[model samples]
Structures are given as structure tokens and as C-alpha cells.
Target: MLPAIIASSRIVFADDALDIVQGDRIQAEIDALRMEIDDLRDERDEASLDATRRTEIRRLITDVVADAEMRTNRIDRPWNVIASADGDFTLEADVIMQYDWVLNSTSSEPTRYGFSLDTLWLSLGGTMFGPKWSYGVCAAVGSDGTFIPEYAYVQHQFEDGLFVQAGILSEYFSIEQAINPNEQLGTSLSFVAGQFDAGQPEGILVGRQFDQWRFWSTLSNGWGQSYIDPLENQRTGVMTRVELKPFGDWNTLYMFNPYPGLVDRGLLFGFGGSFDWGDYAAGTGRSISGDATRATADVSWQQDGVGLMAAAYYQDVPVSQTDGGRRWAAVAQGAFFPVSTWDVYARGEWGAVENGSRSDFAMATIGTSWIPAGDSRLKVVFELVRSWGSTADWSVDGDIGILSTDGDQTVFRTQLQFAF
Candidate 1:
């Protein structure tokens, strides 16, 4: 019976041992062995065994049980978090697919309602020497199905509270720019933050966390700011961001907070400023030198399930080798969580060029984010936008071409996001 059982389980035993086996069938084999021992040691002595033989059976059974228990107790990590047991290296990956439908009456173009591929991308990370050192990479599909590299960088950590990253990185100049789309409450970002501030340059950034103070600074090639090959990136761009968490736990200070529970009830104050001289470089454009600078201040607070945030920014960008006027933008955003996984939010955003000398555009938006399974990685968001006032130079803000030709418009957007 013992040989038959081992044969059926495909378990090969050591020369001096019974067998080595693990996995779900282990417990069954253990139970059967125990029953055999009980029968062998019956008080009636009909099937009694010698003490030496009985001890050997118990020992082998113990080894099998221990191996089974060890295997069963091992942690099962998610598919995205790949790591080695020795803490030497790890990797993680995620895929994001998004679709956008913008229904609006356009003053510059015809009324439009259609489905567009907003974003289809991949996020991947590799850590060579543990969490203290890693690299991040992202790529997105373009309208023509071409692959565009969004981020590629290396991050290193130091013991004295300093960390550094070098790569093609996004500007740390605005609240909206600091977070990814899925981490944001609205489908569309504030016009100003999306347009004038959405520059991803190849550079290096350093950051530190001390008590409640978090500081970050960057010096980079300002990749998208130049059109000239090697000569276009001659100028270095500088940026700095500082934040203070007066009441929250330091660990939560950098969390992608889509809701209030992401951190303890508290307040945060932040500022970001940057200055660079280079052409907005990319594709097949001529590299023309120009000045680009931005400054912003923001405050955020959350208590219970309610949260509020406000930010203001000023930007001066050069175009056509001419000094363009400064652009200003602001937003007052708030959210309420009737239920922990559901939130209702509203935001009022406005932007203008150089003290409103040109023209101004103000947008009001109402939106909600729902996490059906209480998973932060999977989120569904919907937003309604109404814009009034007027915009003369759509380039005054950073909204990619969504607000290209603008006047008064209404927009409806919904997005479903998932990670891992």
C-alpha cells in the first residue's frame, strides 16, 4: 500500500527514507499514514507493530507534513510584483487601456462626438538591489499606432534620507502633473496644468524626506523643449518642489491619494517652481531657444471622508523666438465620500495669459470615482465639464489639443483604469 501510494503521487523517496512530497495531496497522504499507524498500534494487538518500525513510520510522516506545511504557508504575491527570495532583485508590470469620447459644441471646429483612444500604455519597473534601487519605464501608443516612450529612469536611495532619479521625467510643477490619470479624480486635467506645464525632459532629480518636510529638485536636458539635435539640449532646466505635511503620517505623504483614506486626516502645503531656456523640442521641429518658467503653490486637507485642495500657478513660455506673456491658472477642488469606496468631487478651474490681458477661460467640473471592489488599482471615473469665458492662445495652458480652438464648450468624459 505504501509503495502504491508513493507511485500514484509520483514521489521518489530517498534510499533510507519513505518519500518526499508536497502540495495539496500531501495532507491526504499524511492522513492515510496516520490511519495505518492507528490500525498497527491497535490495543487488541491483531495488527500491532514493533516499536522500532512504528517510530520509523512516524518520522517519515513528520518530514512529509513539515514539507507540506512549509509550502502551504508561503506567500502568494500578485502577478505584478515579481521578486526573489534573497531580496536581491524584483520586477513589476501593469497595463493601462483607456478610451475617450468627447461630445461638445466647438466654436473653432464642428461639433464633435466620437470615440478616441485616449491612452493605451504599459508600465514596467525593475529593481536590481532591492527597493532602495530601481528603474521605471513607460510607453504609450500614439494615434497612428506608433510607440512613444514616456518615461525611462533609474532611481537610487541613500541612507541619510536622500534619493535621486535620472531619466525622461515629467515636470514636478503642478498637482495634476504629479499624479497619473488613474490617480486623479477627473478625466481631464486643469487646462493650464495640462498644456503649458506638461513638459517631459530628460534630466536628473533629487529628493529628500525629513520629518514633515519633503523637498525635491531637478536639473534636466528639457527633452521636449528643443527641436535641434544635440545643440537643442544645450541649456539645462531647473525645477524644485517642496511640501510639508503638517498633520499626516510621513509614509502617506507620497501616496497616490485618490481618496481620503490613503492617509490619515491631515493637511499638506506644497510649492513647485521651475525655469528653463530651450525650445519645446520634439519630432521634426527646429531647435529654437526660449525661456520657460512656472511657479505654483497648493494646499490640501482631508478629514474623515471629505477632502479639499486648491492650487495656483503662473507660467511664462516663449514661442516663435519671442517672449510670450506669463500665463496664470488656479483651481479649487473638493471631494466628498458618502461611502468609503465612492466619492463625489467638484472643481473650478480658470486660466489666463499675462494678467488677463489676452483672454481667460474658466471651467467647472463635477465628477465621481467608484471602486467597485474596494481596490484602488481599479477605478472608474466620470466627469462633466462646462467652460465659459474665452481663450485666445490655447498654447497658454497645457491641455494637449483638447482645448485647441476654444470658446464656451461642454464636455462629457468617462474612464476605466486598472493596474496589475
Candidate 2:
């Protein structure tokens, strides 16, 4: 009996020890589960922090890129916005001021001197919808107390090299003047320019532009300087030009061709001519009237640092109570530049006006212009003028008249101009 009792106690003790070992294993499993939960929480928090930092970095980079682009691409005011799809628009503005001094050798009129706002131009242009359609507008404040709409037009490309432009556009005769506004040699229009002005009717113009050529014609009111109807009569005219570039063998010469130069340079030769007829009546009674016709030709050559140009014009004026009148004029200009920023230029012009009832008068002008820092768009010019003929009453002396009768006299002038 004693042996059996001892065996039972041993069995009981062994069973209890086994139960204790199983309980300890359950506790260890609970501890391990808690540690796993804590690790998962730490991982989720770390991931959230990393994602937030990445998002902040992306936002910072995006803002920086947009700001830089704005600075590089914006222009002047009024027409600030162009086309905006994929950033396909542009804006621009130009301002100019000039100071001039005139010394009249025949008149003593206080030696007229003054400063003037030569031009203030604002322009906007861009493409829209696709690359095929483009538009532009240019407005200006003129020195002669006038506001001019310089250009407003839309152009469409139908195919490879053909395009059409229609609007109140520039006449072909005036295109060169518009492009090289800063390089005009004098304060007023040249003799040939005046004649062409009568021939160049300003209104609606149609133009075609190709790889190396452009042709344009216009139907406009023929009154020359007077834009008002009461002061001038209307007329009709047409103008055209053709330009060509040859020498496919000379690539080096092509780079600095004078015809196209820094702006419209190429092997450039162009022919421009115009014809016009108009009628003008004097006084309240239509009793006295005049009819006029004008024609002109322009030829130019340019290469590298040298440029040469000549223009001639003729006008026929027939009026009542006065004999038929005629006028002829010619202008020649040459320029040389050893460097890009400096240029020396000279121009000569001669003009004559005659009528059977009135004595013939002639005018001549010689001028030189200098551009010291050519890139600044600053220029200085000096002009000496002499007038002679039967009716030479056009001479001035320091803003005062010296000789009242027909004779010869000299005039001196200096002009300084800046553009931006």
C-alpha cells in the first residue's frame, strides 16, 4: 500500500508541473503578440511621415518652376495676355524719345530747339488653336500729335509656303520704314517718301509671303498727309515688291548678306512701284480743281557691313487758273559699319517743283548719322540743307527770315534719338 501511495503522489506532481509549463508558454505568446503590435504601429507612423515630407517637397519644386517661367515670359501692359494654351503667346512694347536743334540760316527765329517724344509703341502677337493661325496688333503715339494704329492683322498658312494677311495693314512701300524705325536719317519725310506717300493709299492691304519673297498691294484713301476728309480728297493706288536671293554656292556670304542683315537680310534685291490718281477742289465753289498722279521706284543693295539704296519719284499736277505742274526727286543713301555696334551713314537728296505760272524751285539736303553703341538703339544725325531757284522764299535764319526775296540759303540741324 505505501509504495502505491508514493507512486500516485509522484504522478500528481508530474501532471501539475506539465500544467505550469503550458501556462508559462501561453504568457510568452501574449508578450510576443504585444511586441508585434507595437512594431506595426511604428512602421505605419514612419510611413505617414515620409509621405508627408515627399508631398511637401513636390509642392515646393512645382512652385519654383512656375515662378521662374513667369519672369522669363511676361511683357508690357494693356495687351498683357496673348494665347495661353501650352504657353503659345507673346507681348512686347517699344518707347522712343528724341531731342532736336535747328539753326535756320536765312531766318532768325530763335534757333528752334526742343525735346519730343518720338514714338511710343505697344505690340502683342501670338498663335492660337494651332500653329496655322497667328495675329498681331501694334499701336503708336506719333510725334505729330496723332495716335496711329500701326498694324492689326491675322494670317493663315494654307500649305507649305503660302500665307494670306488682311486688315488695315502696312503698304509695301512703308514696310521698310516700319522695320527700321530707329535708323531713319532725318526728322521728316524724305523727298521720295513724300511722293510715295501720295501713291501709297492706306486702307485695306493684301499680302503674300514666301521663303524669300513678299508681295503686297493696297486699296486706300489717296490723300497724302491729311487724314481728315474735309482737308483732303480721296484717291486710289497700288504697290508691289519682289525680293530674291541667289548663289546657293556661297554659304559664308549668306550669313552676313546685307539685304537681310541683322533683320531682313538675304541676297536682297527688290522692285517697288506705285501709280495713283486723285482730284482736289479749292474753296466753297467747286469751280477750281486739281488732278494729280505720282510714281516711284526703289532699288537697294546690301552685304556684310555695306549698304546702298536709291529711290526716284515723279508727280504730275494739273490745276485750274494755274499751268500744269510737275515735280521730280531722287534720294541716295550709303552706310558702312566695321563693327556690329557702330555705323557711319550718309544721305543725299535733290528735289524740284515747277509750274508754268510760278517760277521753279529746287531743294537739296546732305546728312550724316552715327550710331556709337548700335545695340542701344541710340543715334545722332546732322543735316545741312540748301535751297535755290526762282522762288526760293523757303529759307529760314534762326527761326527768323533774313532774305525775303527768292535766293539761296543754308540750314543746319542736329538730332539725338533713343529707342527701347
Candidate 3:
């Protein structure tokens, strides 16, 4: 009986000790779970604060960038500017019209009384990232309703003063070519330029400016072609020109739309030449491959309400046989500005074709123009022209002619021009 009582007491004591141990284990697990929950809450709070700081920093950075751009870069707009902005960009246009009345006609074109659109041009250009880079484009509407692209080019000017240009650009090849109709002593370019000088070429131009001189050279495809084309319009050409300002910037020259205003002063002397090599198509069932060469020289001076200019040209065209035969042309011109708005001028031209026949033209011209500003001009020009020498004449309109039926021509031409 004593052994049974002792065993029962020991069993009860073991059960109570096991219960206490289980209770302590359960409390420890609860405390560990509570600590994990507290750590999670702390991490969530820190993540929210970090996110807020990042968003504020982004807003501040955006504001700063916007302010900097506003201070440095801006677009310009102006009234009366077509194609480009007048403030930072450039806009250009030229429109011309003329009336010709033929008193007598010897050859095919009998309908003489008419009105003609001489030129219709619109242009846009601008410099970007400062004056070191530039781009421009010009378009023309021909009388025959053809749309032509003119000056579509880009240019980069280096720090050392060298400039590179590519595409279609217009810079006169000679003094005669440099003179626009309104600025010319005559109503049109000399016959030498008309017969041989290609109007404009598409290619690359390299130029440099010195203190008292400027020089440029071009490698390009001739009229009616593009440099990107290597097959059909196989004509490749090169032209180079040099100008000397003996009187300093007083004689600074602009290659296009040159205006040697007597109001300002200086002397400008220039020389230039060009040659074209290609497979040429003259007439039906014929093709000639050879070189066509040309040379021109000119000088101009202006001071104290007086201006004078003279120019000459020479050219050689290969015969259809690609061997012996050749053609040539020459011209001389001068102009005097007597008053602020009045001018007098004269030009003489001579040309020969493959047959060795020579012809010539002489003209006297008078002009009066109004200058509203530096880039805007209006002019009225009158010219009396006489044809002489050989009956085979080259006219300014790119026509080889016999000065009318009797091999003599007397013409009175009047023209009006506006440019801005």
C-alpha cells in the first residue's frame, strides 16, 4: 500500500513540471512574433520617407533644367518673314517680269509682243548652334509651271575659318554672273555666261576667308544633274574663285546679289575659272564626251557716289568628234553710278560656235533703283541693244541667233525688278 501511494505522488509532480515548461515556451514564441511585427512597421516607415525625398529631388531637378533651357535657347518669330524667322533666320525672295515688243522678225519666233516672267524665287536659311553651322533652301516657280529646287544646302564653318558646303548653292562664277539683273548694267547676263556657264550645280564647296581675301572651290554636277547620280548626268565639273579687297572691307564682295553701293567705299578685284568633263548629248543620235573649259576675270571699285566695274570671259568647248573642233566666247562690261539712285552701264559680247563663225552684241543701259533697307530693293532698268559682227550671235536668253531676218537687230528693252 505504501509503494502505490509513493508512485502516484511522483507521477502527479512530473505532470505539473511539464505543464510549467509548456507555458514558458508558448510565452517566448508570442514575444518573438511581436518583435518581428515591430521590425516590419519600422521598415515600412523608413521606405515611405525615402520615397518622399526622391520625389522632391526629382521635382527640384526638373525645375532647374527648365530654367536653364529658358535662359539659353529660344525660337524666333517675326512678321513679313516668309520661309524663315527674320530674327535668327533669313528670308529671301526675287520676282521679276518684263515686256518685249519685237518691231521686226527675221526667223522662226514671229509672235514678238509679250510679257515674260524672268525669275520667281523664294528662299529660307538659318544658322544654328551659333554662326558656325548653317542650312538653307530655295525654290523657284518657272513660267512653264515647273517647280525647281534651288539652294538646298548645308554648311559647316570651322574654327580656323574654313567652311564646307554641300548641296545646291548659287554663287556667281564671274563678275557678270555675280551681277543680278537689277544690279547689272544690262538687263541680263552677258552672252558668254548664257552660252556656256552652267546656272547652278549640286555638290561640295570648300571656302576660306582671309583678312583681305576670300577663296572658294566647288566640285559638282553641272546643270540638270545631281552629284548623287553617277550614270546619266555624267557631267562632273570644278570651279574656283579668288577675291582681293585691296581697299580693305570697303571692297567686300558678296557672291550673289552684289551691290557695290557708291555710298560705301572700296576696290574689289577677282578672278575665277571652271571646267566640265562629261558625256554630252547635243542633238538626236549624237553624244560627245570631252572637256568644256572657261576662264573669267573682273574688277570693281566704288567710292564717293561713283562706281566702276569691268569684266571679261573666255571659253572653249570641244567638238562633237571629241578631237579638233572648238567654240569660244568673250565679254567686257562697265557701269557708273552717277547719283544715289541713278546709274549708267554698257556691255559688249562675242561668241563663236563649232563652225568657227563669230558674232557679237553691244548695249547701253540706264537704271534707277530705290533701297528701302539693306536687303530690300526695287529698280527700273532700260537698255538699248545692237547686234553686230558675225550673223551667228549668242543672245542672253541662251539662244543662238541671227539677230533677226537682216542679220541686224535694234532692240529697246525695259525691265522692273523687286528683291527683298
Candidate 4:
């Protein structure tokens, strides 16, 4: 009936010819359906023109199989998809939110609101079998709300400049509290730069690089600080660091180039100081804790876009009986960046407990930060604090009494952050 509908048409069409059906109008509609099947074989009328040419060739193959199943269901549906391959391994995630506003100028009710979940963070870093061993794991959501583990690490490279690291990481202390946690301007921890409450211990660290000098060392356990405890005792501690650049170009000052469009002048100087003497006992011994000493000293500088840092700390407590007491603390900080997302900061601290009757402390803070779009993952900060001791108790003015009746207490804070 038109060559039996093109020999029982099974539709295997892909040699590309019918550019949308105009090959001389499909050969003049198959030559007018073979002259109407030879005029119905000369008058029997070939069963009504073979049922109207097999219903117009089954409606043109059901409209070309419904437009190829609507473009294969819009490319196998999956909201905004992206997958990778070619040396594999790629994963990422980050979600963080924070808000804090506290003002209590002697509480005639100034303002107070604090919300945190500051980081729901989960990141499983990559690069393996190729970049001389690189690995990472950063987890979050803790402060007792569970899911701890922050930064499980591995980094190894050996030859000349040497390198090594093993398990649970991050302890090189205060490079803006260990490398910018969203550009921290403040939201706690200035009782003299000392809160990262540990966590991530089970260690080994070694580093070396010569020419513009660099060095490193570490040993751990010393009572796991955070992440809700990780075997709290069996005291151990050690740390050492040294760095110097003095302009001999370590890849233009340790590689982080930017300037074509501005922002990134070079200069870096360094030193990191640490010490921890140990043997501690306090599970409720009433009064008797052995040898505990802490030490710190730091200096930093950055050029062009401007950045400067400073640090100091000292702690020694050896009170086993009435007349044997000692305690000490100190802190200092500074920051500036007239643009490149803006920033300004200041800090000061002091502490004491010699001959204890609890009344030695001092604090000061000043801050500002605005990231607008320079995207340190979005940030905004404002801080002003002035605390005066009685051995300052925790936070929120040590939960009221304004540090023993307003001898000195002033606070104003603002924070808004989002990281993802």
C-alpha cells in the first residue's frame, strides 16, 4: 500500500535526510501513495486506500515518539545537576549562621539576643594519589549538640623541605584564631586569646623549609580541650615554631597573589611561641593541682592591603595548699585593613590570682568588620567591651551581677554571619 507502508516501518531513521520532511515533500507523498495504489489496483479501491494510508503512517510515528520523550524527561531530572570525573574526588559543603547582640550597660535592659548554629559545616576535602597525599575532613555542629570532629587530617610530603602530619589537626595557634573563622571580630574569647578548647589530638607534626626560614613541631594529648573530650588525661605537651621571610621571596611571600585589580601587597614576618608544662589534677580534689604552665608569644605582619597581629600569654598555677598559689594571664591584639572588605580591631587583657581572693582581671575590646561582598562568606561585626575583674566569671557578664555590681562592665556587640 505504498510499498506496504515502507515495508512494515520499524522506524530506524538516522542517516539524516528528512530535514524536517521536505525531501521534495517526501517524494511527493510517496508519489501520491503510488498513484493511490495503482488506482486501487484499477478499481477495487484497495480497501479504502488501505485504510487511509494506514492512518497517515500512524500519525507520523506518534509525533516522532512524542518529541523524543520530551527531550528525555528534560535530561533525566535532578534539580541543577553537576557531576565530575577525570581524576575524580570532589566534595564540598558549608552552612553556617550566627546572630548575636548583647548590650548590658548595667541591665536596665539594653538588648540581648544570641542565636547560633554558627556552622553546620561538613567538608570532605580531596586530592589523593596525586598531589603527594592530601586529605581533609572538617565537621561541625557541636557545643554539645553532637556531631563533633573538626578537621581529621593528613598531609605528607618528604624531600628537602620536609613535611608530615597525622590525624586530628589544627594547632598552630592564633593566626587570627587559627586562620580566620569567618574573619572573627569577636563573639567570645578575649579573656586573653585562649579558647579553642582543644580537640583534635592524637598527633605528630614536623615541618621544615629553609631560605626565608620556617620550622615546626608538636606533640599532643595534654587533656583534649574540645569536641566533648577525647580521652582526657595522661598528660603530654610540646610545641615549637619559627618563621621568617625578610623579603627573600618565598613565592612572593608564601603564595597568595592578587593585585592586578588591587589588594594584595606582599610582606610576611613570623614567629609562633608555645609551651605547656603539665601534670594536672582536678576532678574535685578540693585543692591540690600539680604543675601547670602555659606560654605564648607571637608576632605577625602583612603588607599592602595591611594586616598586623600580636599575641602574648602566660599561665602558671601551682596551688596545692593554702600558701602555694599562683595564676597569671595576658593578651594583646590589633588589626586593620582600610579596605578589601574592611576591618578594624583591638584587644587587651590581664589576669592574676596570686594569693587568691579572686579579684584580678581586666579586659577591653573594640571591633568592626564588614565584608559586604568581599565574601569572607558574608560577615558583619561590631563590638565594644570593657570588663573589669573580680576574676571575671564566664560570659554574659558572668551571668549577671555585672561582675560583682558594676565595678566595670560594658558591652555592646553585633554579629551576623553566614557561610556556605
| Top candidate when judged by TM-score against the true structure | 1
- Candidate 3 steric clashes: 1
Error of 4 at 107 (Å): 13
Counted clashes in each candidate structure: 13, 21, 1, 3
How high is the lDDT of residue 247 in model 3?
73
Sort by TM-score, top down from the best: 1, 3, 2, 4
Each prediction's TM-score against the native?
0.74, 0.64, 0.67, 0.27
| CA error at residue 115 for candidate 1, angstroms | 1.5
Between candidates 2 and 4, the one scoring higher on lDDT is: 4
**Candidate 3 lDDT over residue span 1-420, tens digit each:** 999999999899999999999999999999999999999999999999999999999999999987765444443434333332223444433443332222323334452444456666666776765567788887777778886775688999999999999988765477656554445444466545665445667889999988888888988875334434355555678888888887735323432223435245678888988877876454435454678776778787665545566666666656444222354556655555554455566666665555543444343333343333423256666666665544443433422222423245555556566665
What are the Cα lDDT values of the candidates?
0.69, 0.54, 0.60, 0.56
Expressed as tens digits, the lDDT of each residue in 95-209 for candidate 1 is 8766666676656667777767777778888788767898989888888988777778899999997999987775676666776655555565666566545466677889998
Model 2 residue runs over 4 Å out of place are 1-58, 64-87, 107-111, 143-146, 174-179, 186-189, 198-202, 210-212, 223-236, 244-269, 275-292, 317-325, 338-342, 354-368, 389-409
lDDT of 4 by residue, 196-292 (tens): 2334555777888887677777676542333323344445666655666655344433312121223344444555554445433447453233554
Comparing 3 with 4 on TM-score, the higher-scoring candidate is: 3
Model 1 spans > 4 angstroms off: 1-76, 107-109, 226-228, 250-262, 278-285, 319-323, 355-357, 396-401
Write the residue-wise lDDT of candidate 2 on 26-79 in tens digits. Answer: 999999999999999999999999999999999999998877666554534344
Model 2 Cα displacement at 353 (Å)?
3.3
